[model samples]
Target: MDIFDTLDDTAIEEEALMYDYLNQSARKEKIVRPRVDHFKEWDSAEFHRRLRLITESVEYLLFLVKDETETKTQRNQYISPMLQLLITLRFSATGKFLCLYL
Candidate 1:
């Protein structure tokens, strides 16, 4: 199974919450959706909320990874594989965001 598929239900829930928060923040801050004639006014709190959500999400992911990686047979094997997976996932996610932004 894919690394993402290994994420438990709690992780999925947190990820969903993070996405929702980010989307809401983007909508309010007009970062993703520009303020057109019919668009809503910008709100600074939305930006803060988005930042909070992102911070929390990162913490959650780190915790999950740490907890799983602690039982490794050797540090080398665990870290390298984990790092590679994390890097791949990070790049994929970043690429998607870049596409959306562009």
Candidate 2:
């Protein structure tokens, strides 16, 4: 009965219609998209080198942050030690949450 409720219903109906259209097109055309391997691109030597460079850059950034945090904590009387959390992308790829405290 409310305007917001009507807007929500319209959005949900649009999503359902879009999915139904997609299913019908897939059945009619039988189109199959080529499979993609995200890791396959990382198999090359150049990709390895690039990955190494990225890793070093990230490590350097971590080091800078850690050093600055330690320096600030040492001078502050009420501040506590820094807490570092290292979370990877693997869990995010699967729509999961993972917290790793280091």
lDDT per residue (tens digit) for residues 42-85 in model 1: 24444223232343454466566766555547533344333433
Model 2 regions more than 4 Å off: 1-7, 28-102
Clashing pairs in 2: none
Counting clashing residue pairs in each candidate, in order, gives 0, 0
lDDT of 2 by residue, 22-102 (tens): 888888654555433333434455433433334444356456666554543443243321223122233333344442425
- Over the full model, what C-alpha lDDT does candidate 2 score relative to the true structure? 0.46
C-alpha RMSD values across all candidates: 24.0, 18.1
Error of 1 at 78 (Å): 59
Estimate every model's Cα lDDT from 0 to 1: 0.49, 0.46
Indicate the TM-score of model 2.
Answer: 0.21
RMSD of 2: 18.1
Candidate 1 local distance difference test against the native = 0.49
